[model samples]
Target chain A: MITGMDRLAAAIQGKKSDRIPVFCNLIDQGAKELGMPLKEYYSNGENVAEAQLKMRERFGYDNVWSLFYVGKEAELLGCKELIYAKDGPPNVADFVIKTHDDIHRLEVPDDISAHPAFQETLKCLRILKSEVGGKQAICAYVTASMTLPALLMGMDRWMELFMLGPASVRDELLEKCSDFFRKEITAYRNAGADVCVYANAFGSTDFVPMRLFRELSLPQMEKDLKPVGIDGVVYYCGGARMNAVLEQVIDRLGIGAYYLSPLDNISEGKKIIGNRALTCGVINDIMLIGWTMQEVRDEVRRMLDAGMPGGKFLFGTLVMPYNIPEENIRAMLETAYEYGACVEEATS
Target chain B: MLEDVITAYNEAVFDTDRERALKVIHDAVDRGVSPEDVVFKVVIPAIEQMIKSISESFDANLAQHFMTSQIAAEVTEEMLARFRKAPEVVGHIVIGTAQGDLHSLGKRIVIGCLKSLMIDVTDLGVNVPPEKFVDEAVARNAQVIGISAMMVHTARGENGCIMVRELLRKRGLEDRIKIIVGGAPYRYDLELYKTVGADASADDGITAGRVIAGLIKEVRR
Candidate 1:
């Protein structure tokens, strides 16, 4: 039997597979599937690993994640509190870098693998590696240096310092963040994560002006990724449209995969990406909350029609909402599998 | 003279030079420009123009918007103090992040823009509940309630704008106090305002001031 990893590898290498790989980015939804609170489900690697294995088994998707939550990254970097929610993903309750002085004081742990917050994450990765190891692709989330400060000090203050910078302070904070990112990426790769998603919302025009992206965000990201290399790295912009910068990112970063936002046109994205890297077309899962089963099926077909023509494309979803009915998910996956089949007749 | 001040202020703000932007207003004020004229004719229009210029890449220019609104609010505060007589307030609004939603950047941007637009805004802070939104709006006799929700669950969740709308209807205040929502979810789904029981929604904080002003007019009428 063809494994999920095989399909993913085939897609990445621009080779034909049984079907295009489907990545269901159901992070918090895992807790819902396990009949547990998000906090409890995420507190231990066993629970998270179980949830990932079970969800992938149930939905038959192609990828499992090692991401507990985005806020955990902040906790590893001195954020003292995280506000967990019953129905939503957790968020940073208190910014670690509350003031300029706090930025100076913030330190990326010298050995992040020993950090308490990351213990559960490493456990989860080990479990997934033990269970599915070579059969399924394991994704690890890493916030890029340019966007990590938003988690540390909140977006408002980060913007203030970034736009109205006393350059030395902002640069100092970014350097620290970049160092953390390098360590985090290296740690995850060593611990069995096959893919490290380099998430930087500011990389897209949706977050910063083109000039700022080129001058500030790009350079910081380049520095952060230089040590680890970009071979198994996937570039993401936090569900923001990135087609505007797709070519530039490809030219500069030489990243292996691009997770195109729902806002981006699949055809346009494929045209830009060409054979340079794998293109993952993400569905607007927020709309899935209200869309009917038929609507969901239609959207899946539409996306496949646009993205499946090329061999390097993968069908995916953004972080799905907890309220999306099981039937809608069923409809989405069923349609993806039905249309995504790689029979010569279907492909031709 | 006001046009020159507006041009200079726009340039300073576009460059994200807070000090230069403030100096432009201060110099205009020292040159016998009435504070009221400076605000109504110069500051507001400068912000409006800035919004138009950056409309294509609004999210990327958040820093610019944040700085522009902050400068506008500072200038408005100084001018309001120097007004020969109290300027006519355009409207009263209470705004905050919806319950279970702690994202405050959007709400802060909206509050800053509204303040300079002569809207008497009471910030309720983040993670505000339905009862608090209604109670505070009623207590302050505010014309509009603004809820910011960065996530879909909070935007359409039970304790978010939906519950706020439910409370207003239960208390017979729906007609008297209109609701306006701004955040990522609404921007992603334009018609979400109607679904969330809001009178209107805006793409960004600068446009939010105008949207709430319209809602306030509807409430008054």
Candidate 2:
């Protein structure tokens, strides 16, 4: 009997799994399902882990990763004003780096162990490892370094820096972020995280040019992930038509898994990712929100048909929308189970 | 001289040379290029040409797109400041990201697009409340209210455009001001715009400007 963890590990290693593992980005939806306030669930680690586990169990999925707000780490690192909302994660209300002098003053946290967000995330990882480590894979999430300048400085300023400043200025910011993430990844590893998932929205083709995405983001990601001694890392660059970047990242980064957005063409994505790294998304979030259950099932079947022929596929969404219907989610998993198993049988 | 300025500024923007780009504009103005002519003829055309070049190439990335637009916007702002006279406002518009959606890359790009077209825009900044949209539109007598919601969660329900639409109707400004939405969510489903009660939606910033401009024309006519 193959455990869910075993199936995910197998899929990541480019081996034939018992079936295609279903990866649901169910952070907000998990809180809503458990009838917990978004504020409460996001404030503490135990609640975050508990909500994620419940979501995984309900869906019979292969993994449950921590999906906290992207700004938690930034907030801990002295971004003063954070907007906590009832519907979503906290965001930076004000930026700290208002001038060139501020960038020079900013440094990686002196003690990563003492950061409240770090402590909370470690607690979440420990709880997941102790409770569900036997059956489900436990991954920990961190905002990628390339995406953090906007948190320290407002996004408009960050975009201006890219437009106006020398590449060195942008690199200095990324380097500081990289150092912080290195320590964060190490902390998560020490806490027994099975994989380190890096969410680099800025690294996506939607935000950065290919030259910068390749020249800046890829090298910074390599530096961040190289220290993580976990079995694999999940790199998510959120946007469509990123295969050009994805192809380079897969070749350069040592990560064993990739979360290509639903906006991406999955077949071409699969070809870019190849068998070395497991590809884990294709179903656009809008479809899950607006499509009927039958349409959801059909979409899942189509993704599976395209990806399941190869051994390196896991089913997931781009960004799981809040309050997605339980039935549509169930429909996606069922389609994956039924058709994904057929591919499994043939490969085995 | 204008063509030389545009070509030189284009190279500066392409090379990410902000100083040179600014110098080119300033020098052109020193040679008696009116500020408006500099904006309408040189700055806007240079940025538009850059955007067109990027779109033609499959390898163009986000940096080129953002950098080109940012230069155009900055140049427009600089010249407008120097001139000390606001160009005749072709149309008044208000724009922002809806409440809880902090993503502003799309909104900023749209701002550049609108400014380049000589639209008088008052940006309310990110995380704008629904009532604020109506309040500002009414106060400014704006022709359009542009709302951006990047994430699906933000795009749906009260957190995003839907709230703005409902408030617009309640304030009786729904018919007076056209609502246009753009972002990742709307790019996939234009019907989502209809559900949110937006008059129109565009996937890209340039198209959003064109769509909003057309809708404004329809309204004033």
Candidate 3:
């Protein structure tokens, strides 16, 4: 039996595995599996790890995440409060950088692992590593430099400063954000994160102009990834189509993997990526909330048909909705496993 | 002269140059342009055009949208105070994030655009329940309820627009108040608003202003 890690490795190396690897980014859905409050479930790393292991076993996906929530990164930086939802991920209530002066005062803790906000995350990573370290890929999320400030401040304010900038202020904030990003990626790597998802929605043309992406976002991303290196880092744009900049990311950052948005054309993505890096074709999981079983199966088959031809492709989801019916999820995975089987392997 | 002002204002807002945009508006007003004309003819049309011109850079252009909306609201407020007679508001609407969703940026942008378009807006803030959405729309005699949900779970969740739609039906307000939803999720699935029983959905703040205005007309009829 090929391990999940082996399957992903095969896909990454452009070799035919027994079947294509399916990655379910089930974050809040863990609470549903445990019948616990989302807040309580995410408050402790053991609970998150337990849920990840259980969900992986039940759903038979290829990866688990140590990401508590997107807001956890804000909490580590200085956010004082977070709003937890009954059926959604928590959000930062108190933005650390509320004013221009706050940016100057904001500090990236020298040792992020020592920060209280990151302790639970490290614990989750350590446990996932200990239990399924080499067999299953433990994914961790690291917000890229350009997008991290949006977490520190609100997105609206960040946009104002980023687009209509006093260059000094924008650069100052980006410098601090880059420092924090570099440190966070290093910590996640040290704690046994097999894949670091470099999340920067602004990196894609869907969010910014192509010129701005090259001039502003790309330089900061390059700087952030420089010291940490991009060996196992997968460039993600939060589910924004990144095909427009895929070549540039590969050429400049030399990232090993690319998580294409569901909005992106899978065939075009594969053609662009070629064999240079792994291409993950993400399903629009938001639609799963209302899509019929047949719809799910057909969509999964279509994505597999488009992505599986050229090797180095992985089937995945973009933050599985908590309200998605259990049967729908089953249908998606079952279809992936059935249709994603390599032709030669299935015939043999 | 109005055309020059509109052109200057459009270029300033599109550039995300707040200071320049304001200077253009203030200059136009100082030149004896009716406050109403400055708003309806200059600011509103300029913002609509900016949103129309946005193509692949929707997210990146948020800065432009934000500046345009903010400047429009400011100029409208200043102009409203100076109007020879109070300009008639086009319609009234209440807006907020769907329950369990705390995102407010999209809602804020919509409110700014609506205000400049002569639409009266009542913001109920984030994480507002369905009951509040319908109740406030009714109490305020609003023609439409705008729900913003940044996440899939919140956008399609039972407590989101779905519940608000249910509440409207229960209270027999369906004919009176229409529902419109906008957010990242709606952009991903264009027909999600229909699944959630919303009257319509818009892709951004500018389009939202137009959609809600049309819904307001429906309510009036």
Enumerate clash totals for all models, in the order shown: 2, 4, 1
Report iRMS values in order: 2.2, 2.8, 2.6
Which residue pairs in candidate 3 have backbone atoms (N, alpha carbon, C) closer than 3 angstroms, thus clashing? A207-B60
**Native-referenced DockQ of model 3:** 0.45
Among all windows of 10 consecutive residues in model 2 chain B, the one with the lowest summed lDDT is: B53-62
Q: How close is candidate 2 to the true structure, as a TM-score?
A: 0.90
Top candidate on DockQ is 2
What's the lDDT for all of these models? 0.87, 0.75, 0.87
Per-candidate chain B TM: 0.94, 0.83, 0.95
- Residue B182's lDDT within candidate 3 is 98
lDDT (Cα, tens digit) per residue for candidate 1, span A17-101: 7888998888998898789998888889999999999999999988999998899999998777777778888988888888889
Summarize candidate 2's per-residue lDDT along B121-214 as a digit string, tens digits.
8999888888898889999999899998876666775757788788877777766899999888887766888887888987677556677778
Query: Candidate 3 chain A — worst ten consecutive residues by lDDT sum?
Result: A339-348
Q: What value does the lDDT take at residue B184 in candidate 3?
A: 94
lDDT of 3 by residue, B1-221 (tens): 98899888887876667789889988887888888788779988887786666544445445556777888888888888988898888899999998877777788889999998889999999889999998899899999999999988788889999999888888888899999999999988889889999999988877788889899998898
